[model samples]
Target: WVDAPNLASRILSMTQKRIAHDWMHCYQYAPVLIETFVETPRFPGTCYKAANWTWLGTTKGVGRLGNSHKPTLPQKNIWVYPLKKRFRQILCSNVQ
Candidate 1:
């Protein structure tokens, strides 16, 4: 999800505190998810930085898979950061 600054963190933080009863869980592969991508340093974009998202690296580019089952153009990898475990609740159901 693309975030316009702390909007992501703020929403996530709110969810963690108000939802799921604060029971946090982590996936088996959660330790090392690919964060950020390969891109030019601050490529004349994104003027503001989200307080929680740290600049990891960059990616070349991204592309959509074609209908013929072919790889499309590549895109740059963007920034990513570790979401506090509790915030993960937003990805699940709130059913008791």
Candidate 2:
């Protein structure tokens, strides 16, 4: 991990807002949500938590290979942020 100034939390919030704005205005599309994964073994998701992102869960870190499942990668904690006020409603409506 590159050692930089301690501005991760602020940067995350700013970046997410900018993305939502650009998508809605420039592309005429509104993003409902955003997600990120953090490798908890290496780094806890303090920035995401500080930005008010919800901690969903951790990945299984395994995939089924034929009849058996094997570990393929390290488990990562899942985090998500709603970009829209009615993100859940929007998402559910899009499901088919």
Candidate 3:
């Protein structure tokens, strides 16, 4: 949705700060990544790409509500923004 002024990047920065602040205050630990989904058909996720978020992949279009394991929902592209440089290490650490 970033047209010209590039509000998405600013919003993402603000959101990251807010998330870090809230999580640190509530749980004493902050999250390592921020993930978002974009419907590729409708939106090309240009905002995320412009903000330097990494593209992970596309979803399988599966709904997690019932036992039906069919691909019913619309597929969405996955993107992630790492809050920390060592996010992989932090996420994969066994010392938790």
- Choose the strongest candidate by TM-score: 3
TM-score of each: 0.31, 0.78, 0.83
Q: Please list the residue runs of candidate 1 whose C-alpha ends up more than 4 Å from where it truly belongs after superposition.
A: 1-6, 12-48, 62-74, 83-96
Count of clashes, each model = 16, 0, 0
lDDT of 2 by residue, 1-96 (tens): 977775888788788879978887889987889999898789999988888899999988774452446657788999999888988898899688
Per-residue lDDT of candidate 3, residues 1-96 (tens digit): 646587888888788769977999999989999899998779999988888899999998896784688888889999999988999998899765
Which has the higher lDDT value, candidate number 2 or candidate number 3?
3
After superposition on all CA atoms, how large is the RMSD of candidate 2? 3.8
Q: Which regions of candidate 2 are displaced past 4 Å? A: 1-6, 24-28, 63-68
Model 2 pairs whose backbones collide: none
Task: Kindly report which residue stretches of model 3 are placed more than 4 angstroms away from their true locations once superposed.
Answer: 1-4
The local distance difference test score of each candidate is 0.45, 0.85, 0.88
Query: Whose TM-score is higher: candidate 2's or candidate 3's?
Result: 3
Query: In lDDT terms, how accurate is model 2?
Result: 0.85
lDDT of 1 by residue, 33-95 (tens): 224444354353242144344565544344454465443444454655444455446445465
What range of 10 consecutive residues in model 2 has the weakest lDDT sum?
62-71
